[model samples]
Target: MAVASVTYLTRLAGYIALRNRTLSPRIVEVMEAAPGCVLISVIAPHFVSDRPADLAALAITLFAATRLPLLATVVIGVCAAGLP
Candidate 1:
């Protein structure tokens, strides 16, 4: 098999293993990190000259309030982020 196919298979196996152990602390950490990173990225003046801190703050607040698992929020955020 090609290198890419091998890598994909390895990732798939890892995912299957991880899903079997849902709600792990490591996964929670990843879930919180993505929004914080996105919040920071959106706040950085260099990225947006206007510095929409208000919007970023609101988004982060809502994300925090959802109380959903990191994987769910991150997946939703990623999909929503992609749409626009």
Candidate 2:
């Protein structure tokens, strides 16, 4: 597809451009943080909305995330969201 080709070319261009350069530590740190930032971006909409259910689930998940493992936090979020 055209989209896929464009995406591949775009990534290839970045790779070629950076091929001879050493990434700075700051850039590495930002790259490491990218996934978590993306995750927050995805979940952030739920936090900004006025829905009680989403707010409660986000609160429960945030609390559990601090005290529990990733699986437990996800389970708690799912359970909280499923509550009627």
Candidate 3:
């Protein structure tokens, strides 16, 4: 339909634009870290907030993220956030 055709053309245009381009190693590294940087930007306020429970949850989530797999980290983070 109309939506599908628009989506396809948009993707095709992007592919054509970048088909012959190569990113530098430094740029690639920065791009790889961008998601984590954005995540921290979003969460930093809550982590530094005045709420004790939120602080505790942030600490637990940070520790879990460093030591556990993605699924486990998310599970522990959720549980920590829900703790009294």
> Weakest 10 consecutive residues, lDDT, candidate 2?
2-11
On the 0 to 100 scale, the lDDT of residue 60 in model 1 is 53
- Could you give me the TM-score of model 2 versus the true structure? 0.65
Every model: Cα RMSD to truth: 9.8, 5.5, 7.2
Runs of candidate 1 with Cα error greater than 4 angstroms are: 1-61
The C-alpha lDDT values of all candidates are: 0.57, 0.79, 0.78
* lDDT, candidate 3, 6-79, per-residue tens: 65565566557666889788865765565566566667899669989999999999999999999999999989
Point to the candidate with the largest lDDT. Answer: 2
Give the Å error, residue 49, model 1: 7.1
Candidates 2 and 3, the one with greater lDDT:
2
What is the overall TM-score of model 1 with all chains considered together?
0.29
lDDT of 1 at 75: 70
Which stretches in model 3 have alpha-carbon errors above 4 Å?
Answer: 1-20
Please give the lDDT score at residue 59 for candidate 2: 94
- Candidate 2's displacement at residue 45, Å, is 1.9
The ten-residue window of minimal lDDT in model 3 covers 2-11
In the predicted model 1, the residue pairs found to clash are none
